[model samples]
Target: MSAGGAHLKDEGTRRQVVLAGGAAGLISRFCVAPLDVVKIRLQLQVHSLSDPPSHGSAAGPVYKGTWSTMRAIVRQEGITGLWKGNIPAEMMYVCYGAIQFTAYRSTTEALAQLDPHRLPPSAESFISGAVGGGMATGATYPLDLLRTRFAAQGTERIYRSLGGSILEIARHEGVPGFFRGCSAAITQIVPYMGLFFATYESLRPITTQWEQLPFGTSDAAAGVVASVLAKTGVFPLDLVRKRLQVQGPTRTRYVHRNIPEYRGVLDTIGTILRTQGPRGLYRGLTVSLFKAAPASAVTMWTYEHVLRLVQEMELAAEA
Candidate 1:
């Protein structure tokens, strides 16, 4: 192919990847939104420091199975509660996937030009994924906080709309409050994206060759693997981020009542450990894993397939 043709092909592929990833992400989001709601509730549920007997006990009514949790939430809050914060969560994930994947591809391309031989495809993909995830999370972290809070609300206290929730958070906590868990988010994203892309890219060749799958199939498979690894690897950080974000306005009462207080990520972690013990840090691992596993699989699969279809259509148009 001519240089121009090659450029066109790359551009088309990039566009396809974005569309595919986005579609997959959207599907995944809808499928897992209920579980996500449960996860948020688990993360945000408060136990008094004075109630040391129940601290870190997984015996609570809320900490039961998914079906039980769902039933309780619906019974307590109504059907609409299951979809709380759906809009913001969907929007945030879409933007996050788009920005992260686009930036990753673009970054890889640029880096390849600088040192084609030294910068292997895997390395490029890893670096790009990390940078992209970080950038995406950073840009959308505030919305993430909003989504968590909105999702974590009691059924009776649920916001009428996304805007209403945002306004309420702002009014009660101020603008800076929206970024409550940003530090933990960034920490989680860096390693999560790094491992995610690294694992996906590393496995792509084997999956493609052994399975004889289409290009997108291999990509999607890679996404599942990467998501599992990354989520597991940074599970603790995710726990901390959730705790910080969902603490609500009364930090002094809910988080800690001591002199120093839970001002930041470290303090929050320390508080969780001292008060709730190790189990507190792994609060909703079950639901999170259940939601995340298939969510990641579907997201990557959809993203890659969508991108491939788009590319084929574009190619046919050119012909």
Candidate 2:
């Protein structure tokens, strides 16, 4: 989610970068929490998103589409259901943003020093993005798993509280449970981030030529396009990660659904293809794009503005 960081020529500016990164993440998460909840539910459902409820049909889906799923969640679990995993999600985003931006900046510097002439700018951006995104995803993966489990559950709650969920995973599934889908997550995130930063950087200059776009700046517009493209490219892996996160002894806790047990990433893909067809891999794609576009745009725009503000404050103090 990081586009990069402000120039870190000094320790003071470095600190500002971290602060701006965290603020950007919190703001973005708040804007897209509901969309995130819908996307997760759609991804985890075994039945197709369009399938309506039917007593006779075992394959009947509880969630029909983005709006329908939102309505169903409200009907079954109240309006707050849309923010079921907000706590961990916010925490994860904050940590992810800080780590991602710092890592991206550091990695980019390292790459520049390592082979500035050999590596192209796009390749550097791609590599740096991959490293940064991977670090953020790995560090915050437990929280991510918890967020998914929370969002995946319905009125029939599985693990009540965050601490309880942590203990439950530790006790039943052992430590590895926390990272059930980490492989798929990292696999998806690496390329996703690389593609995002590369695409955004490539498009930013061209988009800036417009100059009159009202919503934000060219950076934000580029971010929106980049995120949508990246999310679409690696969407199946994202679905696999969500499905894996909900697996374990509590798999059946989801209401009005029958979740199958998957041995691993490949098995999960196979099951989805066998049961729901190719579309299953992209079950929640529409909602995901809805989330990705605005989330990335907001993050990029906020990060740039906040970084400028923070750096200005730092300069004021020094002066």
On TM-score, the candidate that comes out on top is 2
Candidate models: Cα lDDT each = 0.72, 0.87
Q: How many clashing pairs does model 2 include?
A: 0
Each candidate: RMSD: 4.8, 3.5
Model 2 TM-score? 0.93
- Candidate 2 per-residue lDDT, tens place, 202-225, comes to 887788798698755887999999
- How do the residues 1-319 of candidate 1 rate in per-residue lDDT, one tens digit apiece? 5332232125356667677657766788888899898877666544422333332243332335567678877887788778888899899888887787788777776775673244655666678788989999998898798777677666345467778878887898888788988989999998889888888778766777756665447766777778887888788788788777766554333211221235678887888888778777777777888877778777777766677778889889999
Candidate 2: residue 237 Cα off by (Å): 0.2
Best by lDDT: 2
